[model samples]
Target: MKRTLSLILLTIALGACSTQKPANDPALVGTWKGLRTQTDKCQFLSWTTHLKPDGRFTITFFRDVQQTQAIQTEQGTWSAVNGKNELRTDGVRMPDVYTYQLVDADTVRYVSVAAGPSGDCQEDYAFTERRLR
Candidate 1:
């Protein structure tokens, strides 16, 4: 009876481990673009991001003026953390971490929280439209 109880307990433990969430696929390996929306001002911002296979990424922010002119652009690199669910950008003026969720094979959504010059700023969660080569 003792041996049987031990076997059942071990089996249950192993089963629980097997039910763990699978690791995210490394298919997040390309460039993506999206319309950035500012939560505070309710304005639309343009942005682009490139995810490399070497666990590195680059992002660019653009501003559209009068629906025709490109007014500004900011570029930076990204490093992945927390099993690729979080990323930190290099040289970003804001001190915050961006959390990501894979939407599909080619798309992802990222949310960023930071302290703006005036107060706390949180970006509306935005979907990244994947760019396929």
Candidate 2:
């Protein structure tokens, strides 16, 4: 009887544990665009993040406002943290951590942390519109 009771308790605990959903997959697997806004400055930038199934990612940033002008572009490795909700970019010269929240399948919000000449600067409360390929 004691063994059966223990088994039942263990089963209950396992069931409860299994009920906890895994963190949402990092959804930055496609092109994203947003109006890059800073203190009194705003421009349009396009971003592309590719997430491989093998836990690797690549990110690209491009300036899109200038159709005739040469686009400023950069690319680097990326990783998802905090259950694929937060993204960290590697090999960038500025602030590298981005907190990404998916508003929908076609939209995501991100906060970029950057360094300024005076001190550390943070760009928060920003939104990105997903670009359909």
Candidate 3:
């Protein structure tokens, strides 16, 4: 009886360890905005990203640092993969991967992995996003 119980417990533990969490992170389901300072050519820019629980994401870009002028908006799907955030835009050929860390319950900082510009800019950027809702 003791051996049987130990074997069953081991199997259960192994099964638990094998299960993985869902790809989408619930904490990211909200509106977030950030600003970036660029070169003279690009100037100040702002990005507003809205992530939904259903894996849908929308990003709006502004030409100014204060997010006053809307420039473009892109729709995409987002997921958490291998401890990183992956965003697949609708019309883009490649997905954008970002390494992120939650600063607090209402803030997250992300750094784009050499995947090129995440917006209309010419290079990758690291920025912080604050939850709007």
Candidate 4:
């Protein structure tokens, strides 16, 4: 009887040590810098966005070589849907639903998946973002 109890205790300890908490989407309440590496003219475009917990975000696209000038700025509300696998932005021109993939707590990739007319084409805008802090 003692040997059986010891075996059960050992099994329980081993199981506890082998398990880990599952990873989930990180909080979006921070600053993120993103860049698009591919464009039609092969020019690089970068943007910095600040997201607040109140569901508001402000994104400014860089337009200068020094990254000091902004060509445009977008302010809107953003939310994650489909169990945080997708991001929906409202109040932005050309609002798109993107494939939101979080690699870790500090990294994410956004891919535009909206199809064009007839569903034969889709915008290939893809960008990866890193947390500022």
Measured by lDDT, the strongest candidate is 3
lDDT tens readout by residue for model 3, 28-110: 78999888877765678788999988899999989887778899998988987554998889977688888898889899988
Q: List the candidate numbers ranked by TM-score, top first.
A: 3, 4, 1, 2
Model 3 segments more than 4 A misplaced: 1-21, 40-42, 116-124
What tens digits encode model 4's per-residue C-alpha lDDT throughout 21-108? 3333336568999866645565666788887766667878886545697877767666654434323345434444567777788987
Poorest lDDT segment (10 consecutive residues) of candidate 4:
114-123
| Clash pairs detected, candidate 4 | none
The sequence of per-residue lDDT tens digits that candidate 1 reaches over residues 1-133 is 9999999999999999998755433666677667755665656666566777655666565665223445444344445544244344455555445566677777766666443332233555444565645
- Runs with alpha carbons beyond 4 Å of true place in candidate 1: 1-25, 37-40, 64-68, 81-90, 93-95, 113-128
| Residue 44 miss distance in model 1 (angstroms) | 1.2
Q: Write the per-residue lDDT of candidate 2 for residues 52-96, one digit (tens) a residue.
A: 544455555565543234344444445555523433344544435
Give me candidate 3's TM-score against the actual structure: 0.73
RMSD of 4: 10.8
Q: Arrange candidates by lDDT, highest first: which order?
A: 3, 4, 1, 2
How do all models score by TM-score?
0.52, 0.50, 0.73, 0.62
Off by over 4 Å in 4: 1-26, 38-42, 64-66, 83-94, 115-122
Model-by-model lDDT, in order?
A: 0.57, 0.54, 0.82, 0.65
